[model samples]
Target: MDGLPTRESSPGVVVLPGNRAELVAIVRALAASGVPFVARGAGTGLSGGALADSDSVLITLTRLTRILSIDPIRRRAVLEPGVVNARLSEAVLPYGLAYVPDPSSQTACTIGGNVAENAGGPHCLKYGVTTNHVVALEVILPEGEIVRLGSHAGEPW
Candidate 1:
């Protein structure tokens, strides 16, 4: 059971820890192997962003799904990249706080993918796109460096 399911050189997915420690390990492995890979969310992507290529690693972030913090007073929720879009909003709904952007695939789409694709949904017609609600981002770059992209009080881009 510890072995891979297929004997052939088939596409594979690795589930790593979703914490900071695990993130470091994942990055280290990718860096050491010098392999080109793609970071994927719920696999609800329509742009083929999650498709595996030759010798390409698909780093699944689904296990990282967690709502780290929610600010009812500020109407903001800080979440892991793997957190589903609709779930985040649902978590805050009781407090009258909601994530404005709602992609068609919000139920399955992840925050990471939405941010990467910069998606917009029907609700965006009045509220705006993903970037509008996102205040900040903690991204693990290709080189395995963790970087904070923006601030909560400032522009997202």
Candidate 2:
């Protein structure tokens, strides 16, 4: 929701990519055509950040949900953008670990939106927000270029 600009008008097109490759291709085509687009996770945001203009393209990340890996020993997890906030903690609970950023909307909010908004909840009073727990991010730039930000190895540098 952090990227969209308008709420009243529906986007001209809405795409839900099942994987990263499809997402990249869609982005590339949109860029080539000079079409404005917005990436959306869940529609659970309180702010109108997920709104789009009538001429814009909305790329919903819901189908991209996947927990790539969970390293309990390292206390880290690799996940796709559409992975739900609470679900991550539940998945790792069996490993005797948990993702700490528990926003009130965790039940329905996606991890991507939590990262976008730096969301936090009652637990944040002691644990901190999404950014503090997220170790890495695989992002697609506006020009359709994919890049990795942060290190999966958990090294800040």
Candidate 3:
């Protein structure tokens, strides 16, 4: 999500994909048709980047909130973009782990939005920002290609 804020604006289309495959297909079709679109995760962005304009398609990712995997030993979790920040920490609490970047909006903001904003809060001074903790990503490109990048191992950032 990266664009101007639109309050009270009506979008031409609003899509909520239930799964990754459906999301990919929608993006592919939109790209091929040359339709302008914006993707959003949880719609809790303070930057107003998630708001959609009248002519563009708004792809809301709220339905994609699944924490796919959690490796407590590695301190890494694979989650859909819409999973709330605090939820991740809560999920890992039983494992004696916590997601450290405690943004003020953590209770409402999603991990994807935090990644987009490189979000940090009071813990940043001691723990660093989101990038420092994120090891890898499975990204869907603007043209609808799914590509996995980076090593899910040791790293400074």
Q: Rate the local accuracy (lDDT) of all candidates.
A: 0.75, 0.85, 0.85
User: What are the clashing pairs of model 1?
Assistant: none
**Model 2 / residue 41 / CA error / Å:** 0.5
- TM-score of model 2 vs. true structure: 0.92
Candidate 3 CA-lDDT value: 0.85
Clashing pairs in 2: 1-49
Please write out the lDDT profile of model 1 over residues 28-117, one tens digit for every residue.
788888977777778776665566665777777887888888888877678888889889888988997778778778898889888878
Show model 2 residue runs off by greater than 4 Å.
1-7
Query: How do all models score by TM-score?
Result: 0.85, 0.92, 0.89
Q: Which run of 10 residues does model 1 get worst, by summed lDDT?
A: 1-10
Sort by TM-score, top down from the best: 2, 3, 1
Specify the poorest-scoring 10-residue window by lDDT in model 3.
1-10
lDDT of 3 by residue, 16-134 (tens): 99999999999999999999888887666667777778889999887889999999988889999889999999999999998999888889888988887788889999999888878
* Residue 90, model 2, lDDT: 97
